[model samples]
Target: MKVIIAEKPSVAKNIADALKIKSKKDGYFEGEGYFITWAFGHLLQLYDAKDYDSKMARWKMENFPFIPEQFQYKVKSDPRNRDRQDGGAAKQLRTIKSLIKKREVDGIISACDFDREGQIIGDTIIENINAGKRVYRLLLNEWTPNAILQGLNQLKSNEELLPLRNAGVSRQWADWVIGINLTSAATLKFQKGKGQALNIGRVLLPTLKIIYDRDKEIENFKPEKFFKLAALFRTKDGKEYEGFYTEGKEDKFKTKEYLDNISGQLNGAPAIVDDKTTEKKRELPPYLFNLSNLQGYITSKYKGWTSSKVLKTAQSLYEKKYITYPRTASNVLDDSLTGKAAKVLEVMKKGLPFEEEVRFRKSKRVFNSAKVDSHSAIMPTYLVPKSLTRDEAIVYEAVKNRFIMQFMPAAEHEETKIITKLRNADMKGFFVSKGRVQLTEGWKKVENIKSKEALLPSVNVNDEVETVKNKVSSHETKPPKPHTEKTLLKVMETCGRSYNEEDTTAEAMEAVLSGFSIGTPATRAETIKKLTDTGYISALGKNLQCTDLGRRLVETFPVKELFDLEFTGRLEKSLADIEKQKFDKERFLQLIYQFTKEAVQQIKTGEDVIIHEIASSKRSTEVLGKCPVCGNGVIEGFKGFGCSNWKNGCKFVVWKNDKFLATLRKKPTKTMVKQLLTKGSANVKGLTSKKGNKFNAILKYEKNPENDYFSWKMEFDKKF
Candidate 1:
């Protein structure tokens, strides 16, 4: 008997069905002299810090940079493991080993997914079991029976994939060292007695850094003044055409004198006609849905659903055989696979928005083998989904449509441009005419896409037109917008670099961009949770704002390292090197360890510090009055008295943090007051104390309106 071990139960079931295994056993399905079993995600994980050494459990500078000589793995335990601490994976491992030793068992088939991680899983399991049986990898591109049978006949020796296994092992160990050491060091050093846990990782830090950098960009940006000139003219057809004033050098109107000159000259003159050009072009249907691309589109266009959510739903669809593999990086299919796409389309023809497109010319746009890796982008299989959850349905539809759309003809259109010269109206000045594709509805002939499709009007330079309206709209230079989830993903994917899709620089960033994207789809949601839990960031609906603690943490760090995109770019390159099996994992680990150590040392010795005074502003004189209790200070804005003497031990802070004080509701009544015995009182309404208790108080105040000073008194009246 031959045994096949799969990555997950879902995958095992698919393989079983494909191999015509009708009979199912307790832990596996058996048929055709084969036994197949599966594993949950990473049934075994690397040892924790304490597992290395008991002393290392408590984080310290000396303990950190915790480079274990040899990494260890352990099985995770459950509640039922009360008596037996051997753990789940260990028990499972033993059973598999026992089965491998059976006289009836001949060999093993590593039927895991065809990815780096999958390779590691099978290799590690076999290594732990010390199984000397002949094993080969079964490389199935799809879960269908035909694909499985083809893969079985052409199985490859697993020995050829040594680099992939090495790369995967290094990736895991590197993440462990970087994540635990940095997270522990930062949490212990920065949080101090608060014992706040700030989880950091290679991907998480870079990801959070992406968000914080975007926030900083929005914060530090100062809008500069620039002017644009728009000229309106009439064609022979009496159609109003808007032309922009063209200059040889001054694309941006920077100087006031330059702006004044340009404004005066082009204010109300007849814009001259210069040139006209038009071209016909075709827009190909986009390639199929890779997991990342699908996630990005959903996050941007739909909102709420994250990349992980989309992946999970797509994976479920794949397991159900409603679609092909969900974890593929390739958007195009193999040449051989393209022939089978028409059959997949036939199964998906009934309800898709692009059903007609599927039945049309699918030869040009269908799956191309050159774009495929171990798996193709997700497409519907022979199995049709009868029911699904709301999000699952949405993701299913997205994948289904993309798969079908890829088989359709390229959407065609004509792009037209018309430029005319106004004779010496100004140097290099011209009135431009523009026209585009005559048919706005033909794109629907391929796919019924409404959102991205552009509609254009047909026009010619000689057509007579008149300017019916003339208007000058004033606009201001705007600061860059704060980081939204949508933009942050893009930044992470590109590692903070800006580029066009086809640019070589942009393409170079793609591996690192997609690889180090903030965090893995699995952990990104949890990382965001940590930021909110630490009071570093808060959400006002979907909008995120830094709290006092959050802002201070950012301010405490060097601006360049904290906010610079180049910093992330360099780190991404290092990470990419690991994936490429070029960079030494140990050196990468050392770099992160040293970085954490330096950051902790910097915070420990508070050199070159800036203090933010509690007072709201220097202009509030009422906050400058002498303190009644202290008898030697002025009442500060939005808080207790601040000492008149600078060099003294007056470290008094009376109000809550900036956030709580900002959200008040009403004024206090006399009955609400009861604080004279302890300190001065005032009838402040709706003011919540530091403990989050809301109350009104009666306190006396001597107000000098001229100087805007107030001194509290222990008296109050019922009405103003």
Candidate 2:
């Protein structure tokens, strides 16, 4: 009997169904010559810092940067654990182990998702059980019966996948080392007795830092007034178009002097067409979809959709066999799959509008072996889907249409550039205009898109014309816009570098470089979700907003390396090298270890930002008047000021950290708290109300909680 282990139970079931395995056992399916079982994602994981040495369990400054001599793996322990430690992972492992030990089992097949993490999941179980049986890797990108059978026939030996396994192990260990050490150290030092864990990770910190940086940009932005000049001219055919007046090389000016001088030059002046140039141009179709590009595309087209949602929809399409592997990082297909790609195109274009336009022709833009990586680019599977949801159809059509457009002809266009000039002696004005006319709808025909041309009226070189209109408009330098999931995903994919879908830079494929990105294509969505779930980022509408805590975390953390994109990029580059067998694993481990050690040491000696920020809450006045209830002195505190005898149950307290004040985006001041206790009322300004309107109101103390406790009540009475 041969045993095959898959990533999840659903995948295992799919494999069994494809093989026509009928006999269902307790934890696996049995038939003809196979026994198939599955892992619930990951059945094993690296142990925690304290798990190695119980003394290190309680997080303290001295025990940080805890580098274990040998990282150990065990059954995944979950907080949702039941009678056993690892929820269901322990049971699943035992079932697989028992199967591997059977006398009839001659070999074990690693039929996991075929990624590094997938291989680690299956191998971890086998390694722990000391299974001496021969292990083979069955690489399957899809669960179709034909694909499964083909994978089985071309199974790879374990030795062939050593580089991937080593890379996987290194990533796990590196993440654990940094996450465990830095999180504990920062929490212990900054939070002190506050009990808040500042969760840090290899990828999470940099991700959080990204949102924080944007928030800072918005906060520090200063709006400056600027001016733009435009001249509207009428051509001989009575067509009118606006061209901006340019002064030397400056189009936008800080002062009105340049605008006044330039607009005056063309004021009622005869406009002459100095030059007119037109050229025929052709635009090739975009490259195939990778996970990031696909996510960016979906979110951009459908505003409300996010990267996480796109991945899910794509995964559903993959499972339905309507598309190829969805988690791929490659945008190019292997040259060997040219025939297969042709077949996909033929099947996908059955009822497509421009079916006749799409012919079987291979281009370097679509098929390149060097560009192909672990899996082929996302595309159709030669199975035209009929019953798909709206979202699924959107993504499916995107992938299929992109693939179909690749083999089609280039989009042809007639681009025109016209230069208009005024004044030869008194003053001068040079204006330029551009327009594009679609000569042929090539790939655009298949995409069902028409190019909108900025048509210009017929004009001759040096022909005189009249200025129809002139305007000097005022504008301000605007702050950078907040990050939409589309933009943020691109930023993450490009390692915080500015990247566009059309960018063909060498850094485009630099996914493995540390300075490029922190997480893999398979894990970026989760990292984004984690930022939202942890309150590090707030999804306001379709854009990400950084919260107060998020800002505080970024500003307070002294270990700047954790937040730097270049640092993570370098580390990622090292990991990629590990996969390529170009770098030593020990050196990579040392780099992470040293980084953790320095961070821990810095945190230990560093002053606590949490404690400092809390106690250092900027108060309007240092000390308020005496406590009315206790006749004792009252001073300002982080939350509020209270009678010095509060320890003696005076209860004469004024809370600075009031929920009501927070709702109004206001914080209590020593003077406000003092005046309430001494004079029964105080005048406060700029208080935000429920409807988001700002108003001034008179605040009064009611002394509502009448008991032994001297609790003061606040009320806003007179509003202005």
**Highest-scoring model, lDDT:** 2
Model 1 gets an lDDT of 0.59
Please identify model 1 stretches exceeding 4 Å from their true place: 77-98, 194-196, 226-241, 248-276, 346-376, 416-428, 437-447, 451-469, 498-506, 509-720
Q: Candidate 1 residues 308-353, lDDT tens each?
A: 5666777777667677777665566666765577677777677656
* RMSD, every candidate, angstroms: 13.7, 11.1
The candidate 2 region of ten consecutive residues with least summed lDDT is 611-620
Taking all chains together, the TM-score of candidate 1 against the true structure is 0.71
| Shift in Å, residue 368, candidate 2 | 1.3
* Best candidate according to TM-score: 2
What's the CA error at residue 207 for candidate 1, in Å?
A: 1.6
TM-scores for all candidates: the values are 0.71, 0.81
Q: Give the poorly placed runs of model 2, Cα more than 4 Å off.
A: 79-84, 192-196, 247-250, 265-267, 423-425, 510-516, 611-720
